[model samples]
Structure formats: C-alpha cells, structure tokens
Target chain A: MIFSYELLAQAIVTGILIGGIFALISVGLSMIWGVMRIINFAHGEFLMIGMYIAYFLTAKAGWDPYLTIFITTPMLFLVGALIFQSTIRPILKDPSMNQIMLTLGLSLILQNLALVVFKADVLTSSTAYTRMNFMLGPVVVRGSQLIAFVGSALTAVFLYWFLQKTESGRAIRATAQNREAAALVGVNVRTTYLLAFGIGSATLGVAASLMIPFYYTSPTVGLFFGLIAYVVVVLGGLGNFIGALVAGLIIGLTESVGAAMLPGSLSRVLTYSLFVVVLLFRPQGIFGGKQQ
Target chain B: MLTVKDLKVQYGAFVALHGVSLSVTEGQVVSIVGANGAGKTTLINTISGLLRPTAGEISFEGRELARLESHTIASLGIVQVPEGRKLFPDMTVYENLLMGSYSKRAKQYRKESLEMVFHLFPRLEQRTKQLARTLSGGEQQMLAVGRAVMSKPRLMMFDEPSLGLAPLLVQSIFQTIRQLKEAGMTIMLVEQNVRQSLQISDYAYVLETGQIVLEGSGQAVLENEHTRKAYLGI
Candidate 1:
C-alpha cells in the first residue's frame, strides 16, 4: 500500500468517527463511577445486553437499529436502576472491597447468562445506511458512522448542559462533591445515585445501538469495548464528562493510525503503552481531576 | 418554633448526649455554649438528622421529626450551617449557594434568596465565580452562612460559625448573627466563644460533658460564677 495524504486523512476520519461511539460508551461508566464512587465492574455487561437488544430488534423483528435506540435506552436505564438497587445499594456503605467483589461477580454472572441464552453466536444487524458512504473532499465517511458521531456529540453536549444549567444536574454534582453537605441542603442523595446510574446505563444502550450496525455482538462483545472505555475514562480523568469524549477521540486516532503503521498486535501494545504513560505523568487525566 | 425533648445519642456504647433538652422560640437567638467534647455538635447533628437519637423527640412547628431523613428534615425549613463550613469545595461560590436551595420549596424563591445572600455577604457576590476551596477562611465561612440563608429557612442553626477565623472576622460573623436576629430570623447557635455568643443571644444554655449544667437569659448566664470562671476566664 502506497503512503498517501488522502489515505492518512481517511484513516483519521474513520478513527474520529469510531471514537465518538467510544465516547458514548464511556460517558455512562464515568458518571456512575464519579457519583457513586464505585467501579461498577459490570458496566460492560450492560453494554453487552444493549448490543443484544439492538440485534434482536433489528435482526428478528425487522426494526431499524436507529429506531431501536428509543427502546434499548430506556430498557437499559431500568436495568441499571434494578442492578443498583438489588446489588450495589446494599453494599454501598460496606468496605470498598465488598462493592468491588459484588460488581465483579455481577459481571461474571451476566456474561455467563448471555452465553447460555444467546449460545455464543456472533450476530450483527445491517441496514441500508450501514453500507453507504459519503465523500467530503479527500475523506470518506460511512453513513452509520456519521450518525453515531453526531449522536454521541449531541449526547455529550446535552449531558454537559444538564450538569451545568439544570437544578437536578447541580444537585448531582453537589452530591458528588459532598454527600453529607448535599443532604444538609435538602438534596435527596439516594435519588441522585439512581439517576446517575440509570443515565449511565442508558448511554451504553445508545452506544450499543450505534455499534450494532458495524460491529459483531456476542456474549463477550462488551469486554474489549468496556476495557477501552476504562482507558478513555482514565485518560480523560475519571468522572470528567468532556474529558471522556476528548480522550475517546485520542484513543481512537491512536489505534487507527497505529494499525496503519505497525502490526495488529503491536497496535494494541502501542495503545496500552500510552495508557501507562498517561497513568505515570498525568494520573489525574489529560483534562484534570474529578469534575462533573 | 423548635423543641427537642429528652434527646439521647450514643455511638457504640459511648454516650455523646445524656438526655439533653432545649427549646428555641420564634425570632429568638438561642445560643448553646460548651467546651470541646460537650455534645454541642452532636446535638446540632442530631437535630439536622445526620445523627439519630436513641431516645427523644424532635419537633419543628409541632411536627415530629424523629424518623425523617436528613434531606427531608432540611426541606422542612430547619437548615444548619455545619461546623468547619462544609461548602462544596470543587463548585464555584455561586453554584454552592445555588445548591443551598435544592428543596422544591426554596427553588421558586431562588432569585430573591440569591439577592438577599449577595446583600448580606458582598464579598461572596464578588467571588461568585471563584471555587469554594480557593476562598479565604473568612470568605469560606461567609459563603457557608450565605449558602444556608439561600434556603430561606424558618429556623437557621449555626454550629460553631466562627471556629477558624481571625478575631476581626469573628466579630463580623457575630455581627451578622445579630443582624439576622434583628430581621426576625429565628437562630440557634453553638459556639465555644462564650462571651461573644452570650452578648448577642437572647437566651443561653451552658453544656458540659454532654449535659446542660446551666440555662438562663444571656445576661444571667453571662454573670454566673461558674460560667465566669470556666468559659469567660474572668
């Protein structure tokens, strides 16, 4: 393959588009971890569930994956709320290790459950837009990827606006800052926790819907994506909303460009090396420490 | 407007309060003066629903508040400016004040409350964009009180409002309390500064080792032999 400026530009564009979807996946994890102060190891399982839902809606019922977002997001929100209430809430005040173990256990159970029900089959949903592409000067953008990029950017903007301008959003930020003080000021901290967790899971649903058009869905589909989200979250600074989006783009560009320049395994090695470098020098993240 | 009767609080076999009782009437500045480890903070915390009393009744405007959550108790117009000035450190001064009016009842009057807070603490108004952690000690204390006032509480409680401040700032804080009392805002104050607290309070209670040893008008308590010797150092 001859090295060309057009090829490099195309690769960068594809990386950015994919990075937007990664932002959509990671934002929810950041929100839950930020507010509740729990790692929520099962976050990837929620994404996996979302992917399966999108697949079923599009593959079995002949519904468009884009339209399936409306159904999956709310369903995942409920799932997030239920998981928090049933598993996470009881151990909220217990030792940090207990919360970690519980969420880790949840991740195992969910992955195994999917294996039993879905039978480890790789499934994907295809629409007319999935194969369509548009050219912008020297760069080419896939139709579905463009939609995902636009949707992810809009979601990030909406979330930022909510946190900055809305009353409930401010309450959530207050709780994250000081729970006892928030309660003193009449903010129901428990409800804020539920809202954060629910919203976080709903974002996963949106990501899964966007992803199903181009990616394969299986029991362990969320494993790699979830791991990447953790990297993005850390790279952006844990719990920083805008940081997650920007870090996602950086990681996406790094992966795409690395693959073009190096072997496939070496590309992943390059990404993890970047993670180590980020952890060493800027442990707070590229943006800063924990800010909503 | 507020009454706590036979309140007892304990932490794992250690008693913090031993059946203490106190009352604050409408528009009165009631002060609870005590030395360190005298259960003053515990009493305030219990009333604010942060700590639960093993035995007692707490009523505000004749409604029982013994079993309500902290946020619920706060929503009922009993706001506390806690010890150490627990403002949200990461948030800006304006955002911290905005969070003070988190309850639905206070939300509608938020603009007016902000104006009132700005008038009371002009420095806070100037520092609205500054983070709470970046403010000076005195400014942070002012922000704490200003944040409390933004809730439009029928009864405002201060837990050591002047704990860590310069002498001049302490006088100013006490002056603000007096002005609040003059404005018909019922206030309950807990302080280690016996002389200043008694000077402004309509009524005062002396707490020692988790028990109320003396209760009287501020003047009478200020003149007592025990208070004069121990707390007043005169």
Candidate 2:
C-alpha cells in the first residue's frame, strides 16, 4: 500500500476528536485517585452505567443523547456517592488488598448485572447527526465526533474552573496534597472525598452521552475504554488533570493511526507497546513531576 | 477561655497524657513546657480534636470540644500552627493561606485576613507564588504561622513553632509571637525552648511524664529552681 498524506490527515483528525472523549473519561479517574488515593477499579463500570442510562433514555423517552446528559450526569453523581457510602468508606483504612478486592468485585457485579438485564446484545441510539460528515480540504470529520469534542472541551474547562476558583475545589486539592493540613484549614476531609468521587463518576456521564450518538453500548463495551482510561491516567501521571488530557490525546492518536496502518488486534499491540515504553522510561507521566 | 481538666490519653495500652490539667485565659500567652515525649504534642493535639481523650473535659468559651472533629474545632477559631510546619507541600504560598480561610466565618474576612497575614510575614508575600515545599525552613515556619493567622483564629495554638529553625530564625519566630501577643491574640504554646517561651509567656505550665509538675505566672515559673537547673541550664 502506498503511504498517502490524506490517510494520515484523516487518522489525525479522527484521533484528536476521540482523544477529547478519552481525556474526559480519565479526568474523573484522576480526581478520584488524587483526592482519595484510591485507584478506583470500578471507574469504567460507572461509565458503563452512564452509557446504559443514556441508551435507555433515548430508546424509551425518545430523548436525544445530548438531552440525556442532563439526567445521566447528576444521576451518576448520586450513584457514586451512594456506592461510596455503602462500600468504599467503611473499608477506607483497610489494607490495599481489601480495597482492590471490593472494587474489582463491584466491577464484576455491575458487568454481570448489566449482562443479565440487557442480554449482552449490542445497542446504539441514532440521532439526526449520527451519520453526518463535514469535508475539510483533504480530511473528512464525523459530525458526532465534532460534537463530542466540543462537549469534552466545555467539560474540561468547567472542571478546571471548579477546582481552581471554588472553596470546595480548593478543599479537594488541599486534601489531596495534605489531609491533615486540610483539616487544619477546616476542610471536612470525608465530605471532600465524597464530592471528588461523585464528580469523577459524573464525568463518565458526559462522556457516555457524547459517545452514544456514534458508539455502541453493551455490558462489555467498557472493557477497552476502561483499559484505555487506565493507560491515559497512568500516562498523565495519576491524579494529574492536564497530564490526563495530553496522555489521552497521545493514546488516541496511537490507536487511530495504528488501526489505520495495521490490521486486526495489532492496533492495540501498538497502544500497549507505547504504554510499556512510557512506563519504562518516564513512568511519572508525560509531564514528569509537575503538580497541578 | 480554654480549660482542660484531668485530661487522659492512651495509645493502645501506652499512656501518653496521664491526667493533666491546664487553662488559658483570653488574651494571655500560655506555654506548656515539656521534654520530648513528655506529651506536649499529645496535649495540643487533643485540644485540637485530633485525638480522643480517654477521660477529660475540654471547654472552649463555654463549649464542649471532646465530641467535635478536628475540622469543626478549627472552624470554631481554634487554629493550630502545628509542629514541623505542616503546609500543603505542592500548593503555592498564596493558595495555602487561602485554604486557611475555608471556614465560613473566616471566609467572610478573607481580604482582611490576607492583609493581616501579609503584614505579619512580608517575606511570605515576596514568595507568594512559590510552592510550600520549595521554601527554606524558616520561610516554611513563617508560612505555617501566616496560614494560621489567615483563619481569623480567636485562639492560636503553637506546637513547637521553633522546633526546626536556625537560632536566628528562632529569635524571629519568638519575635513574631511577641507581636501577636501585643495584638491581644490568645495563644497556647507547647515548647521545649523553655527560656524563650517563658520570656514571652504570661502563664506557663511545665509537664513531666504527662503530669503538670509546675504551673504559675510566667515570671514565677521562669524563676523556679527546677526550671532553671533542668530546662534553662542556669
């Protein structure tokens, strides 16, 4: 096959658009990890929950996927807080093994429950913009991805402002940096934990809604997305927001470009290979040791 | 006013504070002098609601503090400039001070508090954007004190405020304490620097093995024979 500039441009555009979504997904995980110091294994399961909620809302209420975001994001927040109260908070001081087991077990339970109820068959919702496309010089961009990209940018901006400009946001960062110091400043550390986890889960709602127009939904759909999220967060340096954004884009470019050039599962091989190389060299992430 | 009666703290079977009592009247500089592991920090921490007292009564301005959490106690304007300068390591000096005003009552006075803190430590204003961890040891101590000041603290608790500073810095810190005292701030100081602490202190208590071995006016404790021989090396 001849190497064509058009194909490269196409892959780059596609990668960037999807990269925005990946960044959104990992930002939630980053906040949770930073404030709580818990690697939430069920992070992707919550995304799955978001997708399912969006799918059903579109199917049953004839709602657009975008409209479902208004419902799904807040719903996911409540879900995250409830789950924390029930499971994570009780065993917070327990050993790492207990936390891993409980979170992994929670993930398995969510997946199987969805499988039992939704029957594992793939589902998708079609909006008017689903199959639309826009041609720009040498590359064509999907309308759905453009919208998702816009949504991702807006969400990121809001999150950045929230963390920087608000009292609660300052409390979260202080708690993340030094828990005892945060208490000295009169921050309710436990409440901050709950808020961080809830906001983290809520981010998945926005991502799921954006993807529903172009992506399929199933209990197992989160498998690859979750794996990608883990890579993005690790590459961004755990708990670092800007790191996740840049790393997410890097992963998106690798996956899309690899898929365009290589066939079958070889694309994932490329992504994981990059992950390994990154881990071996600059494991602190793409930003080195820079703090947010 | 803050008062503790028969305060007892145990770490598992180990008794850290064995039935101690102390009091700080409003606008008075009260120092708790003790040797290392003599329960200075334990007593201060217990007052700040960090540790549950096994058996005790702590009242602050007529309110019970034994059932409150550390953050709640902090919100009541009982802030502590903790030992070792526990600043938020990754945050900027400005941000750390901003966090000190997170409580509602302190939040309203954020502007004035920032001004007051800056007045107390002009060096902190010079390095406002630098991260707390990057500051020199003395600067970190000043930032710690500045942060507590930003909380609009009605009662400031100092736990070894001069623990890890240079001799020069120690003089500067005690000087700052003297300034706060002039401003009529109530303080509870825990220190091993017996001479300097007692010099600025209005009232003082000497703790030995978690018990109050001596309690009197600062001049009285400073002039005592045991303090001079054991702590002051006179």
Candidate 3:
C-alpha cells in the first residue's frame, strides 16, 4: 500500500497500453456513427462476438489469436453488413428513436444468443505471451498488452490512410459531411454506409483477436469494455477517430490512476463525472471541432 | 441532350410540377425563370433524379431516366450544382473538386478536369487548401461550379447559382456561365433573375404555379409583353 514513483509509472504505462486496445474497439463505433449517424448500440455485442470467434479459433483450432484476425475481421464485416441491410436500412427513414431501439434490441439478441451458444462459462485463450512481461526500467509491461497497443496504433494509421488518402475513404468522409451532396457528386451514399458499418465491425474483430490473449471472454464481457468505449467515443467527440484514440488513453489512465487513488468501485464513477464535465463545457468533445 | 415530357411531380398531396415539358438541346443554355415555389426546383430535382416524377418521362441522351437513382443519374453525366452551394464544407476546396470526379467515367479525366476548373477559377486554385466553408459566398459558388465540372458532366444544371450573392458577384457568376457556354458546356439554368438569365440564355421558359406559361427563343421571350410585364419589371 506504500506509494512509490515506480507504481505510478507502471500504472500509467499499463493504462496507455490498455488505452490502445480501447481505441481499437471504439474506432469502428466512431466510424459507423460518423458516416451513417447511427449510434450502433450492438457495437459491444459485435466485439463480444469477435472475442468468441477468436476464442474458438485459438482454443479448438489451435490457431494463434492474432492470426485469427484474418478470419474474424471478414466474418464480422459480413455480420455488420447483414445487420445493416436487414434491420437498419428499413428504418433509416424513420425517426432516430426507431434506430436506437433497433440497435438496442440487436444488442440484447446478440448477448442472449452468446449466452445460449457459448454457455455462461468464462473463457480465455492462454497463449504463451499471455503471462509474459518485460521490464522497462522500473515499470513492467505485459507482452500481450504491448502487442495489443501496437496493433491498435497500426490500425489507427491504416484507418487514417484509408479515410484520407483513398478515393472511397474520401467518399465516406463526404457522405459523413453531407449525404445529399455526396449523392449529387455520384458517391453511392448507401454503399458508403454499408462499408462504414462493415469496417467498424471489422475493427472490433481486430480488437477481439488482440484482446483474448490477455482478457477473459463471456457473454457480458463486451458490456464492461463497451461502456468504456462509449465513454471514450463521447470524450473524443462522437465521430472523430483520432479523438477516440486520444480519449481512449485518457479514459484508461483515468480508470487506472483513479482506481489507485480511490476505491475501485468509485473509479468508474469518477470517469463518468469527467464525461459529464466534458459534456457541459465542450459538448462537441475535446478534439471535435465543428467538422467530423 | 435532355428532355422532359408531361412531367408531374408531387410531394404527398401537393403537386410541384404539373405536366411540365421542357428540353435542352446539345450545346445550348436553357433558362427556366420563375418566382419562388414556382416548380423550378421541382423540375431540376426531378431531372437530377433526386425526386421521381409522379407521372411523365425524363430522357437524357435518348435514354429514359425515370427509375434511376440520383447517383446513377449523376454518373450518366447529368450533374447539378444544387441550391445553396452544397459543397462539402469540411473538405478543402481541392478535395471538394476531387470529389466531383467520383463517378467511374469521370475518374479517368480527373486530372484534366481539375486543371480545367483551376483555369476557370484561379481563385479556387489559390484557395485549394482552404475549407469550402471558409471561402467567400462568391468563391463558394465558383467552387460549386468547379466541383460539378470535375464530374465531366454532359448536362450541367444550375439551381439559382446567383442566389444570396452581392450584385457584383452575381454579374461575375453570369459572366462565368456565359464563358462556360462559350466553351461548349450544355447548361440548364433555373433562376429568379429573369432579365440576366434571358440575356445569356439561348432559349427560355417561364413557369408559374407548377406550369410553364410561356416558352420561346430567349430574345423572343424577353421581348414578349407578358414576360416583360410579369418578370422583367418593365
């Protein structure tokens, strides 16, 4: 219980690494929201499904969790697209309330389905690197967490390039800015919506694959992490990718440092309190300018 | 290159374009002059495939476009510089121009089209890095026109391009339209500025309450007693 500079440094390092993983999880949610303006309530369930996919691939098929990204990402992409076409598209012209209820319903269905299929038992992919850690001066960093951090950073870079540099990416941004204008310029707004949702779901696959090595998988596991992601997305501004990344780190640090300073039960309350303060002063978010 | 026959568009119980018919030949500037809520926007929107006609036909280059989506219509070379200068505000002027060539057919000629746009509006070239929202009203209109040109449109429609501009800027916009016509771009202009539009237009139509009341060569329509009295303030 003795306070030490080493403990504080370790907490900050671990928070940052964990924040990277959180960034990966929330970026997709941010993208879907940005392009389609749909707050996908089922986003957490998508991550949960990704975790289950990675779990099976590693535990049963003896595949490396990281390598399963190739399968999990595509599978989730299909799932995301299917969900969009079947449920979201029909009510697109309806009020925002309809969209919200539909996604919330989807979340519930996915959660219960996972409980039915994967059972209530908690599962983890105990890879060789799961328990491995390396000492960085006085701070020790877990190998799996470090890998997740690196993967999240790589995903962010790739996503940034994809949205900014590629033609389709530009189309997505244009659609996000103005759907009617995008259509006027011959950008297929509907297709862009599908692609955004698919990519958003796919990022969860990457997050899941990276996460299972160090974390447990359960039907409700996504709820906990997913709540943090919403906080991160809100803190970062709803639709800003880079903001989500920065906010993810902020949230991670807040949780870890807050837990160290206060009771664990009260740390989450502290995080929400920060979110409320942000909402009150800068509703557009810290990095969210007038633009997306 | 564009023709509409007996077009009737409705929004629920309200009829916007009541059996309106119009045509734009290749290499011509056709102006539709009307007061606000006189079905000018309805006709433009219908032609651009943003709104489907309740009854009638729209054919572009001899092909029917009644059932096509807006993007499909746009890809087939019928682009509209929508009302209010709907440029992607967050995007840079350069990026907005690039987005204009988003169609498959237009993509190949993007470089040349950009050069052409830059040549037409040197100010846009200078403000390439500036966001569309940051540009002045006149520059935004130029950027909107520039963005439409990027698509390499065969038939470019302008919806009140001179609306909400200073008188000087409006004159410049009309001058730009004339220059575009000189360069052989087909234009369909919808305007409230009857005299200026009639002066530059090859042919003109006068619409009132969702119906075309008069149609003729621009000079003939300009000199007509009814057009002069109702629209020209003579």
Per-residue alpha-carbon lDDT of candidate 3 for residues B22-116, written as tens digits (9 for 90 to 100): 99999999999999999999899888888988999999988999999999999999999999988899889989999999999999999999999
For model 3, residues A23-135, the per-residue Cα lDDT tens digits are: 88888898888888889899999999999999999999999889999998999999999999999988888889989999999999999999999899999778897988999
- Kindly list the per-residue Cα lDDT of model 2 for residues B1-234, writing each as its tens digit: 999999999999999999998899999999999899999999989998889999989999999998899999999999999998889888899999999999998999999999998899999999999999999999999999999999999999999999978999999999999999999999999999999999899999999998999999999999999999989889
Q: What is the DockQ of the complex in model 3?
A: 0.87
User: How would the candidate models be sorted by DockQ, starting from the highest?
Assistant: 3, 1, 2
DockQ of 1: 0.83
Candidate 1 pairs with clashing backbones: none
Number of backbone collisions per candidate: 0, 0, 0
Chain A TM-score of model 1 comes to 0.96
The estimated TM-scores of all candidates read: 0.97, 0.98, 0.98
> What is the lDDT of every predicted structure here?
0.91, 0.92, 0.92
TM-score of chain A of 3: 0.97
What CAPRI-style quality would you assign to candidate 2? high
Q: Which stretches of candidate 1 lie above 4 Å from their native place?
A: A1-6
Candidate 3 chain A weakest ten by summed lDDT: A256-265
Q: Write the per-residue lDDT of candidate 1 for residues A1-292, one digit (tens) a residue.
A: 4677887888799889989988888888887888988888888899999999999999999988889999999999999999998889889999999998998899999999999999988987778878989899988889989998998888888888888889988988888888999999999889999998998899988888888788889999878887999999989998888899899999998888777767657989988999999889998999866586
lDDT of 1 at B43: 96
